[model samples]
Target: MFKIGYRTVKTAVGAAAALFLAQALDLQFYSSAGILVILCVQNTKRKSLKVSLHRLGACLLSIVFSFVVFETIGYHALAIGLLILLFIPTAVMLRMEEGIVTSSVIVMHIYSLKTVTWPIVWNEVCILIIGIGIALLVNLYMPSVERELKRYQQLVEEYFKLLLHEMAVYLRSRESDWDGKEMIEAHELLHQAKALAFQKLENQFTREDDYYYRYFTMRIRQFEILERVMPLVASLSWTYEQSEMVAKFIESVGAAVRPESTGLISLQYLHELREQFRVMPLPTTREEFETRAMLLQLLSEMEQYLIIKSEFKGKHTYIQSV
Candidate 1:
């Protein structure tokens, strides 16, 4: 299968548009406008705009250096080299290194003309404007990633459900043969989801606080808690009565995992479970004591997980259960 990406399409169209417009306007070194378009088009709008500004600034600076150095040192090959030697450090110091390559083209155009005239300067300016302007226009058509973000959200929730349900199963039977591959899957899923969420954030101009990004951050925190809980669950050599109780609670929590879940109900249930454990009979043997102690720690970790989700709900008040 073969496919063309959105950025590729934008670059091709933008470059063609710049070249046609520059030729129509009769600008010298008109092809340079197309090169600028190719260089300016970026993955994100913010990045494209940033790079455009850098290129524009660097080109203007190069024109100034070329006028001064070429006029003073004579319009020769060595003058061009000398201009670059000075321009590189100044561009780096101004944080416009991204524009260095694009600006070099402008320098070459001035060198070919072998003169520092107002018309030549204006010609290069028009070229920069046409190329960078077309790029900015093309970049403004960023496709929405809301659907993809939602898909990742559903995937992360599914992974959480599977992990929690399996942990419950382990606590109940203690004799099952279950490989913990879902843990690794869930970790990787969260990593990818977070990256996508951040990309979504970058795509926006005014919305500084992206909901999905924060959502993934909360999930990552809960996943960390799960990582800690996994060892405790696996270390249970013998299941006690307390283990069954915790298993049932985990099942309930897993059942409630969703985007709209506040985890308030589950948090209240956990509080009651802790109280119930406090009134239970003391462990009869050393092994029972250790197992019961691990169960208590597991309960604490689950509480942290639910608490994280509840905190997320506080920030997003529209998330309500049906």
Candidate 2:
């Protein structure tokens, strides 16, 4: 979660060490330096390892990307002009999106600089590994967990902002609820929220840089509970057409006075809807408006479901009125 770029200061220590070796080895230091830059700046520990590897591999195998481009286009003069056009599809074929970017850059530079071969390529790779090793070592020795957690918090905030944004349909609709597009978008957001929730559940992250990570993950059980409840909430949402009869049937009743109907505007409706949820059934009781509010409050305000400490402790705190 740490920006490999932001770790430049920490990574610099590694760079210096790599430079010392590159110079001692009498290798092409500049080429090594560029490789180090890519390894250090463009990758995280393991998340985007593939992208970084692809970049390195692309650079390693760039003769292929470049050779194809130059051999195919070098004589035409049209090849240099349509360089990107020619290389991109090939990059895709290689399953390298960022690799293509790196490859294209390498291709253009190769065309302009006319340089490529193992004499320098292997040295570049070594330099890159050394630079990345520095960063990985720096991080391993003194991880930026606080920074990672801050990223987690930032992502959580983003999730909420997205959740709030997602609420436009639920808030605006009077006759219906979220449609397929909205639901699909909601599902995507939910997936993001779910992934973000894992950050909260995890506990390995630590350090000044990872303080937020520790905190964010500490309360993971709460989010886990929420995840358990989400599928049920989603089940409440039927297809626009599929649930049309159910929607209208519920709509016609005076939700407050009717036993079968929770008034469209009534908290009683929310309570009944929640009570009937199949995922985690709510306590059966004399269906009341207060009970509905309580259920919603539990989910809305509470962060963790471990203990029902107080009425306001959990989902109750953040529950908003319908």
Strongest candidate by lDDT: 1
Residues 1-322, model 2: lDDT tens digits: 8555545665576667767767777765444554454454433444334555666665556656566667654634576667666556656687766555555455555566465566645655565566555545554443334455445455554443333333322322322343435334434544454454443333234222332323334334434554454343343422332133223322322122211221234333334544554344444544333434433543343223323211222122223321
TM-score of 1: 0.92
Q: TM-scores of the models, in the given order? A: 0.92, 0.42
CA-RMSD of model 1:
2.7
The TM-score leader among the candidates is 1
Model 2: residues with Cα > 4 Å off, grouped in runs: 1-6, 29-35, 38-44, 72-77, 81-83, 93-95, 112-120, 131-135, 142-322
List runs of model 1 lying over 4 Å from the truth: 313-322
Q: Taking the tens digit of each residue's C-alpha lDDT, what string does model 1 give over 103-187?
A: 8988888888889899999999999999999999999998888899889999999999988898999999986576888888888
What do the candidate models score in CA lDDT, each in turn?
0.91, 0.45
